[model samples]
Target: MLAVQHCNNSALHVDEGFSNQTQQVLGVAPVRCRENLNTTTNPTAAGLSMTLGIVSNIIALIILAKAYARLRKRSKATFLLFASSLVATDLAGHVIPGALVLRLYISGTAGGLCNQSDATCHFLGGSMVFFGLCPLFLGCVMAAERCMGVTRPLLHARMVCTAHTKIVLVMIWLLALSVALLPFFHLGTYIYQFPGTWCFINVLDNTSITDVIFVLLFSGLGLAALAVALVCNTISGVTLVIARLRKKKCHRRSAKSHDIEMVAQLVGIMVTSCICWSPLLIFGLMSVIRSYSGSMGDDLETYRTLMVMGVRLATWNQILDPWVYILLRRAVLKKIYRITTGRSDLKGSTFRRWEISSFQNSMKSVINRN
Candidate 1:
């Protein structure tokens, strides 16, 4: 009986030690444990959200694959490749992290697993950062590619091949991965966030200078990418407009139409990204500045709630991105136009006149040269 009592005491001591370690590592107070547990009480909602994201991304991927197969022989294949990569990345973003969350929920531990396992927390946190930034980077790359193609067609055609684009995509992935891994190198740190559903870079009221810098770097890169995309898309759109106005008829109708389709898609992508991601990026900047300034004392909880909302908003970007390409195609738009306007042959009639004018101009030039 005495031996069993001693064994019970030892077990109790070990439990206390484990609890202390978890509290220290997670930087969560004992008072907040109940709150975190409560957050997971409705695992059905979280599971459903994850399920929707995963399924939407999977559907987008299938559509993109079909679209890519159709365009694989064209010069526009490069843009499709980029779009496909972005969708695939977003799919992974949803699947890997969603699986982890669901697993924790199923195990009935919810956030407890992350509180206990530093490796799991870091991996989840890094993935959040990595996936969050990759789409922004890829958007910027696509915008720049389209800008170059529109503004400097000769130069763009000479360069920017499929092999080079693949290399660029790999480089962008590495860049985002490097940023995500920075916390592991002591540049900053990841900690269990409020309600403890997942881990992310620490941006709480007690965030350190390094943490502030890390958050700033993330938001800054994302915002910069958006800004660059805006500028490039604007320039590409203007160039296309000017070219169309200056040359009412062109022999390269197919190429011109392709450029227009690409620019329209880029515009849709830029708008969707800005709408979905700006909230989180801006909130991140504000949180870090407020934390660094020591001015978030009374409003800490408010800011935390905002951060959670911002993250939810950002996640929608992945879901909406693929639809931009899927529905923004010229064929799709023309069909919609036909349905609404009751003019099935409007585009063909309009383009036929331009084609005849272009052929006449070609003949005139040839006859004058002769």
Candidate 2:
């Protein structure tokens, strides 16, 4: 994410100075208005991604509910908690919002998805603004928590609790909303840009101040949050490795094979985070700068295609999250598989008591499903 933000800044600074007066580029013009300031994307692609996201989110929700039920009264894994949360918010911010935009475009809603009312736009925009930073901040929090767990394991157990976690969550919500909502407050334009097929905070008002605020909220603050998370996470992962080596030197039992497996699962989760999110960090600033500076060409169309692809990548996190958690914790997979198969696995469980009881108990509710 740091790399992406740096790359975006490098591209923008090289092409156009920060002066807004010299930058009079147009925004997404999906109408017949040949005056300028327009762009377009395939509603088909948007719709398809939305469909996939919705399906994925639904699956994740089911798998998670069963897992939670099965794990009740057990020592729940923190990464599992983080993964569950991140997936939920990813759907809210990226996938579902994108779906709404595409729905409006297909329905030919003239003023975006606000029912052509400023009030609705404000509600929608504020909603989008409020939840917008969720995935980014959630990722960071997950990473930070993971790092602290590895670096300061004893502290992790003592410092964090349901109440403390809730407080932290409240703070994250307040902070993200405070930063993202700043634009709506200052611009007094909540649903700033609809552009027919996609929606974003419009930065192309008469003053172009909207553009700056949009850039700052989505790019500036989003990048900062991601950077902090990535640094903490990277440190945590490295420390895990170091700790393992020291444990080996001391001839103390390192992380058990199962524990190592769990870390591997979390690593996959983190890698997907980078894949889905980094592109958005890089392209968001570049796209805005290009829009501001009139630097886009036919090749720029290709870039826009990639940008949309990147945004979709973030959306995929919602769907992929279920699998990540299931892979980390077997109970989730057991429940999902039982739900699909309609019967518990009778194939032959030669496993030990703890594993068998956990899987069977998890599958009990699942097997009873329709």
Candidate 3:
């Protein structure tokens, strides 16, 4: 800890590197963090991350509120309701540590309190692992659900039992959390290194087998989630397309169309997940597995730097989440329109609705190709 002037008559122990140093506050010491590092060209990725986070939370909150109002009576499992939990966790994973880092960064890079000791780190660590896993696996589970719904409507409707859905969802979250923490409990901590943040724990400094294991384990997890999302999304798209073509002669076309809508949204969800995390996931595996895989160490620092950037980009998910809701779930945008306008915006011309629908379909097709 370093001593700097206080707003009051007294001076205080504060990390000065992150601060503008223009003024002081009473009894408040600025937390030191890595954000003091140069971000001149970066737009304070943390700041952008925060803005994205705020927007997403607002959108999600709006959607949930509207959904509660609209389907207030329906106890069925809707995407908005189920995905809300994931949204909450993602917000925490992205925001809590991000805020802390920004604070420390502005205070001064030299030193500051980080995680109130190791226990706190574990909490953040566990939170990151838990939340990160929940979204990806949930996407996969969701894809399976969509496939059943479109491919086997009767079975899908019957299988929509609350008990089963709840059980599967809970298990998914638990398994993801457990998988993330195995390395930590076995030996060390999971770490995070973005452009301006490093949560979980300090990295490579420990150099224990446990540390390396945790790194591989978490990275592997990220990669797995991305892969599952891609494969499931592709299959879901193809399956839905086939189902629609086969049922063209029946009056079930509209129903089939709705099924396709759901599938497209599900695919969009996974595509977004893949785009957000794939780069980091790929590089993370290489870094962790290099010892066993071939050599690429001639540019280790470059790769490390790339890993940092990739992880930062991965966080785009949190920021993009609100937009995702608006596009993928009708509930969110409807609410946004209603709240902002004194009247309903859904009463647009038939042409407008068709346009919106067409845009969504095109986006799904393109995202699927990616």
Highest TM-score model number: 1
Q: Using alpha carbons, what is the TM-score of model 1?
A: 0.83
Against the unseen true structure, what C-alpha lDDT does each candidate score? Answer: 0.76, 0.55, 0.56
Over 184-208, each residue of candidate 2 has an lDDT whose tens digit, in order, gives 5665344334232333454332225
Q: Supply candidate 2's per-residue lDDT for 275.
A: 73
How do these models rank on TM-score, best leading?
Answer: 1, 3, 2
Report the C-alpha lDDT of model 3 over 1-370, residue by residue, as the tens digit.
Answer: 0011111212233444435243234445544343323422232655665766766767776776666565432322444455665566666766665665556556543122332234444555566566666777777777667667656767876676556777887888788867757755656554434332344433422245565666676767667766766776677688766655665656342233345545667767777887876776666656655633445547555665766666566667666655665576544445666777766655673324544654565466558668
Question: What is the alpha-carbon lDDT for the whole of candidate 1?
Answer: 0.76
TM-score of each: 0.83, 0.65, 0.68
* Candidate 2: pairs in clash: 26-37, 27-37, 27-38, 28-38, 28-39, 29-38, 29-39, 203-210, 203-211
3 Cα displacement, candidate 2 (Å): 25
Backbone clashes under 3 angstroms, per model: 0, 9, 10
